[model samples]
Target: MKHPMPALLILLGLAIAPVAAQQVYSWTDANGTKHFSDMPPPPNTASAQRLNVRSGVTTTQAVEEPAAEGEPAAGSGPAMAAAAGYSDADIKRNCAAAQKNLERYEAAKPAEDEEAEVQTRYQEGLSKVQSQIKLFCG
Candidate 1:
Protein backbone atom coordinates (compact mmCIF):
# COMPACT_ATOMS: atom_id res chain seq x y z
CA MET A 1 0.00 0.00 0.00
CA LYS A 2 1.02 3.62 -0.48
CA HIS A 3 2.59 5.26 2.54
CA PRO A 4 0.01 5.59 5.27
CA MET A 5 2.39 7.70 7.38
CA PRO A 6 1.58 10.90 5.48
CA ALA A 7 -2.15 10.38 5.93
CA LEU A 8 -1.69 9.58 9.59
CA LEU A 9 0.43 12.66 10.11
CA ILE A 10 -2.20 14.85 8.49
CA LEU A 11 -4.86 13.37 10.70
CA LEU A 12 -2.75 13.96 13.80
CA GLY A 13 -2.14 17.54 12.82
CA LEU A 14 -5.83 18.14 12.27
CA ALA A 15 -6.66 16.64 15.63
CA ILE A 16 -4.14 18.83 17.44
CA ALA A 17 -4.83 22.04 15.55
CA PRO A 18 -7.55 23.37 17.83
CA VAL A 19 -5.54 22.69 20.96
CA ALA A 20 -2.47 24.32 19.46
CA ALA A 21 -4.20 27.58 18.67
CA GLN A 22 -4.86 29.87 21.61
CA GLN A 23 -5.81 33.45 22.37
CA VAL A 24 -3.55 35.80 24.33
CA TYR A 25 -4.89 38.50 26.62
CA SER A 26 -3.36 41.63 28.10
CA TRP A 27 -4.27 43.57 31.24
CA THR A 28 -2.80 46.09 33.61
CA ASP A 29 -2.04 45.22 37.19
CA ALA A 30 -2.71 47.14 40.39
CA ASN A 31 0.72 48.70 39.85
CA GLY A 32 -0.38 50.00 36.44
CA THR A 33 1.83 47.50 34.70
CA LYS A 34 0.96 45.76 31.43
CA HIS A 35 1.02 42.01 31.10
CA PHE A 36 0.27 39.44 28.37
CA SER A 37 -0.75 35.82 28.68
CA ASP A 38 -2.62 32.94 27.12
CA MET A 39 -5.12 33.00 29.97
CA PRO A 40 -7.52 35.86 30.59
CA PRO A 41 -7.02 38.12 33.58
CA PRO A 42 -9.11 37.34 36.62
CA PRO A 43 -10.55 40.69 37.63
CA ASN A 44 -11.62 43.57 35.39
CA THR A 45 -11.81 41.14 32.54
CA ALA A 46 -14.37 43.35 30.86
CA SER A 47 -11.55 45.75 30.26
CA ALA A 48 -8.94 43.20 29.31
CA GLN A 49 -7.24 43.57 25.95
CA ARG A 50 -6.89 40.93 23.29
CA LEU A 51 -3.87 40.53 21.04
CA ASN A 52 -3.97 39.35 17.46
CA VAL A 53 -0.99 37.11 16.97
CA ARG A 54 -1.25 36.87 13.20
CA SER A 55 -1.29 40.64 12.68
CA GLY A 56 0.78 41.53 15.77
CA VAL A 57 -1.90 44.03 16.71
CA THR A 58 -3.65 44.62 20.00
CA THR A 59 -7.28 45.52 20.62
CA THR A 60 -8.35 47.37 23.72
CA GLN A 61 -11.76 46.89 25.23
CA ALA A 62 -11.56 49.75 27.68
CA VAL A 63 -11.14 53.47 27.31
CA GLU A 64 -7.68 54.92 27.73
CA GLU A 65 -6.82 55.97 31.24
CA PRO A 66 -4.43 58.49 32.68
CA ALA A 67 -0.76 57.71 32.61
CA ALA A 68 0.93 56.26 35.64
CA GLU A 69 3.30 58.20 37.87
CA GLY A 70 6.79 58.64 36.32
CA GLU A 71 5.32 57.79 32.95
CA PRO A 72 5.05 60.19 30.06
CA ALA A 73 1.71 61.88 29.72
CA ALA A 74 1.16 62.10 26.00
CA GLY A 75 2.28 58.79 24.51
CA SER A 76 4.12 56.18 26.50
CA GLY A 77 2.57 52.84 27.22
CA PRO A 78 5.12 50.08 27.76
CA ALA A 79 8.27 51.32 26.06
CA MET A 80 11.10 52.15 28.42
CA ALA A 81 11.68 55.85 28.98
CA ALA A 82 15.37 55.78 29.85
CA ALA A 83 18.29 53.51 30.54
CA ALA A 84 19.07 55.06 33.92
CA GLY A 85 22.76 54.37 34.57
CA TYR A 86 23.08 51.72 31.89
CA SER A 87 24.63 52.51 28.50
CA ASP A 88 22.67 52.36 25.26
CA ALA A 89 24.15 49.01 24.28
CA ASP A 90 23.58 47.59 27.73
CA ILE A 91 20.01 48.75 27.73
CA LYS A 92 19.40 47.16 24.34
CA ARG A 93 20.95 43.90 25.40
CA ASN A 94 19.04 43.86 28.68
CA CYS A 95 15.80 44.63 26.88
CA ALA A 96 16.28 41.78 24.45
CA ALA A 97 17.08 39.36 27.27
CA ALA A 98 14.10 40.49 29.30
CA GLN A 99 11.81 40.07 26.32
CA LYS A 100 13.08 36.56 25.78
CA ASN A 101 12.60 35.71 29.45
CA LEU A 102 9.04 36.99 29.34
CA GLU A 103 8.33 34.79 26.36
CA ARG A 104 9.76 31.77 28.13
CA TYR A 105 7.68 32.44 31.23
CA GLU A 106 4.60 32.76 29.09
CA ALA A 107 5.24 29.47 27.35
CA ALA A 108 6.25 27.42 30.40
CA LYS A 109 4.11 24.43 31.30
CA PRO A 110 2.77 24.07 34.80
CA ALA A 111 3.07 20.90 36.80
CA GLU A 112 -0.15 18.97 37.29
CA ASP A 113 -0.29 19.58 41.02
CA GLU A 114 1.57 22.88 41.18
CA GLU A 115 -0.34 24.96 38.70
CA ALA A 116 -0.94 27.82 41.09
CA GLU A 117 2.71 28.03 42.10
CA VAL A 118 3.79 27.91 38.50
CA GLN A 119 1.38 30.66 37.56
CA THR A 120 2.54 32.82 40.43
CA ARG A 121 6.15 32.39 39.47
CA TYR A 122 5.37 33.18 35.88
CA GLN A 123 3.62 36.40 36.83
CA GLU A 124 6.38 37.43 39.16
CA GLY A 125 9.00 36.80 36.53
CA LEU A 126 6.92 38.61 33.96
CA SER A 127 6.65 41.63 36.22
CA LYS A 128 10.40 41.81 36.73
CA VAL A 129 11.27 41.53 33.05
CA GLN A 130 8.55 43.93 32.02
CA SER A 131 9.77 46.50 34.50
CA GLN A 132 13.32 46.09 33.27
CA ILE A 133 12.26 46.54 29.67
CA LYS A 134 10.18 49.56 30.51
CA LEU A 135 12.85 51.27 32.54
CA PHE A 136 15.87 50.73 30.30
CA CYS A 137 14.85 49.98 26.74
CA GLY A 138 12.52 52.76 25.63
Candidate 2:
Protein backbone atom coordinates (compact mmCIF):
# COMPACT_ATOMS: atom_id res chain seq x y z
CA MET A 1 0.00 0.00 0.00
CA LYS A 2 1.37 3.44 -1.11
CA HIS A 3 0.35 6.80 0.35
CA PRO A 4 -0.71 9.36 -2.29
CA MET A 5 -0.29 12.64 -0.40
CA PRO A 6 3.45 12.87 -1.06
CA ALA A 7 3.00 12.25 -4.78
CA LEU A 8 0.17 14.79 -4.96
CA LEU A 9 2.29 17.40 -3.18
CA ILE A 10 5.16 16.77 -5.59
CA LEU A 11 2.83 17.18 -8.57
CA LEU A 12 1.50 20.43 -7.13
CA GLY A 13 5.05 21.72 -6.69
CA LEU A 14 5.86 20.84 -10.32
CA ALA A 15 2.74 22.64 -11.52
CA ILE A 16 3.82 25.88 -9.79
CA ALA A 17 7.50 25.62 -10.80
CA PRO A 18 7.04 27.61 -14.01
CA VAL A 19 5.58 30.59 -12.12
CA ALA A 20 9.00 31.05 -10.43
CA ALA A 21 11.24 30.08 -13.34
CA GLN A 22 11.64 33.39 -15.17
CA GLN A 23 15.22 34.37 -16.05
CA VAL A 24 16.49 37.88 -16.84
CA TYR A 25 19.61 38.82 -18.78
CA SER A 26 21.77 41.97 -18.67
CA TRP A 27 24.43 42.78 -21.22
CA THR A 28 26.22 45.69 -22.84
CA ASP A 29 25.73 46.30 -26.51
CA ALA A 30 28.33 47.45 -29.08
CA ASN A 31 27.77 51.11 -28.11
CA GLY A 32 28.61 50.34 -24.44
CA THR A 33 24.98 50.77 -23.46
CA LYS A 34 23.62 48.37 -20.88
CA HIS A 35 20.44 46.46 -21.66
CA PHE A 36 18.30 43.96 -19.82
CA SER A 37 16.43 41.32 -21.76
CA ASP A 38 14.25 38.33 -21.08
CA MET A 39 16.05 36.26 -23.71
CA PRO A 40 19.60 34.98 -23.48
CA PRO A 41 22.47 36.72 -25.24
CA PRO A 42 23.73 35.74 -28.66
CA PRO A 43 26.79 33.51 -28.98
CA ASN A 44 30.31 35.03 -29.31
CA THR A 45 29.21 38.09 -27.34
CA ALA A 46 30.57 39.27 -23.99
CA SER A 47 29.43 37.66 -20.77
CA ALA A 48 25.99 38.73 -19.58
CA GLN A 49 24.61 38.97 -16.05
CA ARG A 50 21.69 36.70 -15.26
CA LEU A 51 19.01 37.16 -12.65
CA ASN A 52 16.15 34.98 -11.51
CA VAL A 53 12.97 37.04 -11.60
CA ARG A 54 11.35 35.81 -8.40
CA SER A 55 9.60 37.65 -5.59
CA GLY A 56 11.99 39.41 -3.16
CA VAL A 57 14.88 38.68 -5.53
CA THR A 58 16.95 41.76 -6.19
CA THR A 59 19.16 42.25 -9.26
CA THR A 60 21.89 44.57 -8.21
CA GLN A 61 25.68 44.64 -8.21
CA ALA A 62 28.14 46.16 -5.77
CA VAL A 63 29.99 49.31 -6.75
CA GLU A 64 33.75 49.36 -6.26
CA GLU A 65 35.29 52.26 -4.39
CA PRO A 66 38.05 54.14 -6.16
CA ALA A 67 41.50 53.69 -4.63
CA ALA A 68 42.92 56.68 -2.79
CA GLU A 69 46.16 58.26 -4.00
CA GLY A 70 48.32 56.48 -1.42
CA GLU A 71 46.46 53.18 -1.61
CA PRO A 72 48.01 50.20 -3.38
CA ALA A 73 46.34 48.14 -6.12
CA ALA A 74 43.24 46.22 -5.07
CA GLY A 75 44.74 42.70 -5.17
CA SER A 76 48.09 43.68 -3.63
CA GLY A 77 46.65 45.38 -0.56
CA PRO A 78 45.47 43.76 2.70
CA ALA A 79 41.95 42.35 2.44
CA MET A 80 40.75 43.53 5.86
CA ALA A 81 38.94 46.84 6.05
CA ALA A 82 38.54 49.07 9.09
CA ALA A 83 36.05 47.55 11.51
CA ALA A 84 32.53 48.77 11.01
CA GLY A 85 30.11 49.72 13.78
CA TYR A 86 28.08 46.82 15.13
CA SER A 87 25.34 46.47 17.73
CA ASP A 88 26.12 44.81 21.06
CA ALA A 89 24.46 41.55 20.05
CA ASP A 90 26.28 41.54 16.72
CA ILE A 91 29.62 42.12 18.41
CA LYS A 92 29.01 39.34 20.90
CA ARG A 93 28.03 36.89 18.16
CA ASN A 94 31.03 37.80 16.02
CA CYS A 95 33.42 37.39 18.96
CA ALA A 96 31.93 34.02 19.86
CA ALA A 97 32.12 32.76 16.28
CA ALA A 98 35.73 33.88 15.95
CA GLN A 99 36.70 32.23 19.24
CA LYS A 100 34.97 29.00 18.27
CA ASN A 101 36.72 28.93 14.90
CA LEU A 102 40.10 29.64 16.49
CA GLU A 103 39.64 26.88 19.07
CA ARG A 104 38.52 24.40 16.40
CA TYR A 105 41.56 25.11 14.28
CA GLU A 106 43.89 24.88 17.27
CA ALA A 107 42.49 21.54 18.43
CA ALA A 108 42.61 19.97 14.97
CA LYS A 109 46.31 19.58 14.15
CA PRO A 110 46.81 19.87 10.38
CA ALA A 111 50.16 18.11 10.69
CA GLU A 112 48.27 14.91 11.62
CA ASP A 113 46.88 14.93 8.09
CA GLU A 114 49.18 14.24 5.12
CA GLU A 115 47.53 16.70 2.72
CA ALA A 116 49.37 20.00 2.23
CA GLU A 117 46.12 21.69 1.08
CA VAL A 118 44.40 20.82 4.37
CA GLN A 119 47.33 22.23 6.35
CA THR A 120 47.29 25.43 4.30
CA ARG A 121 43.54 25.83 4.74
CA TYR A 122 43.83 25.25 8.51
CA GLN A 123 46.50 27.94 8.79
CA GLU A 124 44.46 30.37 6.71
CA GLY A 125 41.28 29.79 8.72
CA LEU A 126 43.18 30.21 11.99
CA SER A 127 44.67 33.49 10.79
CA LYS A 128 41.26 34.74 9.65
CA VAL A 129 39.68 33.95 13.02
CA GLN A 130 42.55 35.65 14.87
CA SER A 131 42.06 38.74 12.77
CA GLN A 132 38.30 38.64 13.33
CA ILE A 133 38.81 38.49 17.11
CA LYS A 134 41.19 41.44 16.98
CA LEU A 135 38.79 43.44 14.85
CA PHE A 136 35.56 42.64 16.70
CA CYS A 137 36.42 41.68 20.26
CA GLY A 138 38.91 44.46 20.83
Compare the candidates by lDDT and give the number of the best one: 2
Across 19-58, the per-residue lDDT of candidate 1 in tens digits comes to: 5555777888877778889887987555587665553565
Indicate the TM-score of model 1: 0.36
TM-score for each model: 0.36, 0.37
Task: For residue 27, give model 1's deviation from the true position in Å.
Answer: 36
Error of 2 at 19 (Å): 69
Task: Note each model's CA RMSD in angstroms.
Answer: 16.1, 14.6
**Span of 10 residues, lowest total lDDT, candidate 1:** 75-84
Q: Per-residue alpha-carbon lDDT of model 2 for 1-138, expressed as tens digits? A: 399999999999998887656778888888887888878887666868887877776757676777777653343213222234465567667878888888887888666656888878877888888888876565
Candidate 2 lDDT (Cα, whole model)?
Answer: 0.72
lDDT computed for candidate 1? 0.68
Off by over 4 Å in 2: 1-83
Model 2: number of clashes? 0
